[model samples]
Target: MTKESPLKTLIGLAQDDVDTAAQRLGRLQRERGEAEAQLQALITYRDEYHARFTESARAGMAAGSVRNFQAFIDTLDAAIGQQQRMLEQADARLEAAKPEWRRQKQKLGSYEVLQARSEATEARKSARREQRDADEHAARVLRMRASNP
Candidate 1:
């Protein structure tokens, strides 16, 4: 059975935490992107509706028609209302996700720091062990030579 050093184990745990945090961050980013796209689409739809409404009104005025202009105005208002609601929802979602994303980023930073510390500790331990072994071997060689002389 192979035993793992405590520092190595800690480093592994930290890395796993970092990976998880990164995944969460990525998910949040994707969500934000989707929300932004949806918001932009809604804005585009609103603009198109506005343009149609204006054109309809102008045509109705030229033809002395009332019903078409009224209908276009109603449609434009409804579309604008829907777009406003969607924009509000998107903004809320984005605001809510921002804090969570920030927290995940902070957690990733902490994990990285922990991993770095663990690695440094492990490296120091390895160097110390190597130095101790070398010192022991030199001491043994000196004893053997003195005994032989």
Candidate 2:
């Protein structure tokens, strides 16, 4: 059984960490996008509702109806405020995830660089060994031919 190099093992683990971090970052981004979209929808709905309320008031609503419209608008405004807060929280979470993702990727890159250097060192050693063997073989052949002559 061949033993795996420690650097290779570290590289594998780093790759897994990087993948996990990337997935987490993607999830955070998706959540933030969904929150932002929901907030936008809420704002658009509130604006449309306010416009309708204004049109109705101009068309001569009763005092009770005017109060009801104002109350409902206030409720919509409160909901919009809550949605804005939710979106802000989502944005914060997404921002927090980014650094972790970058760190994991950097670790993986460092491992890869180490592995490349190790391979290059091995190749140089192999080349030197091959040259030494060739030189010894040529010297042995020359000595044998001179002895026979």
Q: Which structure among the candidates has the greatest TM-score?
A: 2
Estimate, for each residue in 1-149, the C-alpha lDDT of model 2 and write its tens digit.
99999999999999999999999999999999999998899889989988988888898989999889889989989998998999899999999999999999999999999999999999999999999999999999999999999
Worst 10 residues of 2 by lDDT: 50-59
Model 2 — TM-score against the truth? 0.92
lDDT, residue 70, model 1: 62
List ranges where model 2 is wrong by over 4 Å: none
Model 1's alpha-carbon lDDT is 0.71
**Candidate 1 per-residue lDDT over residues 92-122, each given as its tens digit:** 7656766765676676566667768878898
Candidate-wise lDDT, in order: 0.71, 0.94
